[model samples]
Target: MPRIELKTEIKANKNIVFDLSRSIDLHKISTEHTNEQAIAGKTNGLIGMNESVTWRAKHFGIYQNLTSKITEFNKPNYFADEMVKGAFKEFKHEHHFAELNEGTLMTDFFIYKSPFGILGKIADKLFLKKYMTQLLTERNRIVKDFAESDKWKEILA
Candidate 1:
C-alpha cells in the first residue's frame, strides 16, 4: 500500500475544524471539480462512527462509486474511514486533529493499493499517487479555507 500524508494548519478551534472535516456537504463543495456527490447512506451532515457513505464521482474520465465506512472515531481528535467497496484493492484514510498555539493542526493519512497487481503498480508510479495526493490536498485546502473564516457556519450549523 502507498500512503500520502498531509498536514494543514487552520486558524480555528479543533472542534470546528474536526466537524467541518467530517461534513459531507463540505466534501461535496471541495470536490465540485470532480462532481463528487454522496449518493447513498449518510449523504449529508457530520458522519459519525460506524456510519457508511457511498460516493459517486468522475475520476480520470470514468465515473466511479466508492463506499466507505467509518471504522474508528474519537471525537475532535481522530477518525478513520476504510473502503467497503471501491476501485482500489484496499483503502484507509485516517484523520487527526490537534490543538495548536494559534489554531488547529489537521493531518491526513491516506493509504491505498490499486488493483490489477503490476499494472496497478505501474499506474500508481506513473500518476495515481500524484492524483490521489492532489485530491487530498485540495480537500484540505477547502477545509482550511472554511475553518479559518465564517464560511464553516453554513455547512456545520
Candidate 2:
C-alpha cells in the first residue's frame, strides 16, 4: 500500500473549507483535465456520511469507474471515504480540518494498494503515486481557491 499526505492552508472558515472538500461539483471542476464525473449516487452537491458516489474518469488514457463511500464524518473537523469499488485493490482517504488564525488547515491522508502484487509496487514506484499525488494536489488547490473567495457559493449554493 502507498500513502500520500498533503496539507493546505486556506483563508476561509473551517466549515466552508470542509464542505468544499466534499463537494462533487468542485471535484469535477478540479479534475477537468481528467474529465472526471460523478455518474451515480450523490452526483451533485456535498456528500454526507454513509453516502456513496460512483465516478467515471479518464486517467492515463484509460477510462475507469470508481465508487467511494463516506465511512466517517464530523462537520468542520474530519471525514473519511473508502473505496467501495474501483481499479485499486483498496483505498481510503481521510480529510482533516482545523481552524487557524490565518484561516483553516486542511490535511489529506490517502492510502491505496494496486491490483497486482509486485507489478503494482513497480507501478506505484514508477508513476502511480505521483499521479495520485497530482490529483490530490489539484483537488486541494481548487478547495483553497474556492474557500478563499466567493466562488464556493456557486458550488455550495
Candidate 3:
C-alpha cells in the first residue's frame, strides 16, 4: 500500500472548493491530456455518496477503464471514493476541505495497492507513484483554478 497526500490552499469558499473537487465534469477537463471520460453511471455533474462512475482513459499509450464509487461523503467537508474495478488492486481517494480565514484548504489523501505484488512495488519505485502524483497534482491545480474564479460556473452551474 502506498499513500499520496497533498494539501492545496485555494482563495475561495470551502463549499466552492469542495464542489469543484467532486465535479465529474471538472475531472474530464483536468484530464483532457489523457482523454479521460466518464462513460457510465454518474458520468457528469456532482457525484454523491454511493454513486459510481466508469471512466475510460489512455495512460502510458494504453487505454484503460476504471470504475469507482463514492463510499463516504459529507458536504463541503469530506468525501471518499474507492475503486470498484480498475487497474489497481485497490484504491481509495479521500477529499478533505477546511475553511481558512483567507479562503479554503483542500487536501487529497490517495492510497492504492498495486496488482503485481513485487513487480508492482518495483513499478511504484520506478514510475507509477510519480505518475499518479502528477495526475493528482494536475487535478488539484484545475480545481483550484476553477474554485478561485468565475470559471467554476461553467462546470458547477
List model 2 lDDT by residue over 9-125, tens digit each.
889999899999999999999999999999999999999999999999999899999999999998989999999999999999999999888799999999999999999999999
Question: Per-candidate TM vs. native?
Answer: 0.99, 0.98, 0.98
Q: Which residue pairs clash in candidate 3?
A: none
- By lDDT, is 1 or 3 better? 1
What C-alpha lDDT do the candidate models reach, one value each? Answer: 0.95, 0.95, 0.95
In the range 78-97, model 3's lDDT, one tens digit per residue, is 99999999999999999999
Structure candidate 1, residue pairs in collision: none
Instruction: Give the runs in model 3 whose Cα sits over 4 Å from its true position.
Output: none
What's the lDDT of the predicted structure labeled candidate 3?
Answer: 0.95
lDDT of 2: 0.95
RMSD of each: 0.6, 0.7, 0.6
